[model samples]
Target: MSAVRGLEHVVTRLSDSCGQGHSGSLLEAPSADVLSCSMQAVVYYGVPGDITDVLPRIGEAGIAVWGPQDGEGRDMPHARGTVSYALTYHRDHGRYPDGSLMSTPVLEAAGMRVDWDRPGMPMPSRFEGFVHSCDPDGGHPVYERCSTAPKEPMSMAAARDQYGTVLTFSLGEPGSSAYQYFTVPRRQ
Candidate 1:
C-alpha cells in the first residue's frame, strides 16, 4: 500500500472508531523552515456538506494562499465530513485565486522531510505540572500532566499572576524543555 493510503487508512480508522465526532486533525512540529511539516485534517461528524467549506470562508476572512510559486498555499484533499462519500472531490479555490494543487503527495511533501528529528519536551501527563494552567484554548489534548508534579521531580520555578496564579515557567537550568499548559479565565 502507498504511504498516503496508509495515512488515509490510519486517519479513517482514527476518525471512525475513536471520537465523539468525525473530526481529525494532524499537527507536526517545525514549519516555515521546512525541516518538518505540520499537517492537520479535521472531520466533524453529523455536519452538513457546507460545514466542510469553511476553509475558504476563513480565507475570505483575510488570509491569502500564495500558490506553488510563492509557497503559502494549501491543496485540500478528501474533505468529506458528511454522509459517506457525499462529495468525493471537493477542492475549491474560493478566496485564494492561486490556491490549487496538481498532486497531493507533492504538495504535502513540500514540508515533509526524511531526516527530521522529533523535538522532545517534558510533557505532563495531566493538566497539573503546568507552570500556568489555561483552557484547551483551541487545540487537541494529545498529552496529560501531573496534578501536582511530574513522576520525577525536576526543579522548575513558577511565575504567579496578580491573583497568585502560576502563569509562566522557566527551567531552573538550561538544556531542558517542558510541555507547559494552563488555563486562564477570560476577562470580560
Candidate 2:
C-alpha cells in the first residue's frame, strides 16, 4: 500500500475501533527524512483503541507508526497509561517540537545514557527515573522520586506543577515505529 494510503487506513481503523470521537492531522516531513514523502499521520483516539489485533496490520502497511508500546503489565486492549501516539511518531520521524529535546540533557546529566537498544534510562521503559526540578537555572537537578515500577502514569500538568518536568511513558496499545523520543518540558 502507498504510504499516505497506509496512514489513512490506520487512522480510520483506529478511529473506528477506539471510539466514535477521534481527531487527527497529517503532516509532511522533509523528503530527506527517513519518513516517506507522504504526510505523517497523527491520530488521537478520545478513547484509545485496543491494538492486539491491529499490530499485525502495521507491518503489512510497510509504514512506521508508534504508541504506548504496551499496556502497563495489563492484558491487551487497554488504554496507554503514559506516552501519546503522536509524540512517539514525531520523535521517530525526527519532527521535534522545541524544548522536547531538553529532557535528553537532563537525563544525561543524571548519569543516564540515551540508549535505545538496552532497557533502562532514556528508554520509555525507564521514563519514570527522571522528573524536572523547578530550578531551571540550577540545571533543575532536584528530581522528585516517583515509583520506578509502573503503577499509574502521571498526567502532564501534574508532573509539570509538582516536578517541573515529566518522566513517564504511557502504556498503550501496540503500533509501529521507526524511532521514538519523549517530549518532557521544563517549567517556564
Candidate 3:
C-alpha cells in the first residue's frame, strides 16, 4: 500500500479503538531541513481519567505502544503519563512521492542507514535500546536516553529525522499539562 494510505489506515484503526468524538490532523516536520519521504498525522482525544486501560485497545489495533511512563518517572510531574509509537511504512516503488531524501543526520544519529537504491523497502525500525526522557529541564543523565526526547526543544530537522512520517495519537484534556507535554515543538 502507499505510505499515505497506510498512515490513514492506522488513523482509522486508532479512531475505532479509541471510540468516537476524536479529531485528527496532518503534521509536518517543524524544520524545513528535516524533510521526510512520507506523510504524517496526529489524532487527539480526551480521556476521562488515566489512559492505562485504553492502551490494550490501542495495541489490538496493531500499533506498538512504547511507554506509559508516568510524570514522576520522567521528572515531569504535570504529565500523568506518556506513550509513543514509531509508525512504519513501506515505500511505494521504493521512493518518496516527491523524491526527497530522508535526513542523513537523523539516520546517522540513530545509527541507522537507509538503502536509497532499494525500491519498496520498509522504513527502518526505530533504533533499539534507548528510552526517551520526558524531563522538562532536558537534563536527564541516563546513558541510554533517546536522542529525540519529546519534552526537550529540538531542531525541526532533528524532529523530522527522528520521527520521519509518523502518526501520533494523544489522549488528554486539551490545554492541560498532559496535553502540553505531548505537544511537540515546531520551532528550532
**C-alpha RMSD by candidate, in order:** 21.8, 20.9, 20.7
lDDT tens string, model 1, 1-188?
11111111110100101111113347553222211111221211111224224323322333223122213333333432211111222333222235554221111122111110011222232222232342222334333221222233223212111111111111211121111112222222
Q: Which digits, one per residue and each the tens of the lDDT, describe model 2 over residues 28-83?
A: 43222121111111121111232222333332443332322444532123222212
The candidate maximizing TM-score is 3
Off by over 4 Å in 2: 1-41, 46-49, 65-188
TM-scores for all candidates?
0.18, 0.16, 0.19
Off by over 4 Å in 3: 1-38, 65-188
Clashing pairs in 2: 65-176, 80-171, 80-172, 81-171, 82-169, 82-170, 82-171, 83-170
Ranking by TM-score: 3, 1, 2
Q: Write the per-residue lDDT of candidate 3 for residues 1-53, one digit (tens) a residue.
A: 11212222122111101111112236642232221111111231222222233
User: Residue 10 lDDT in model 1?
Assistant: 10
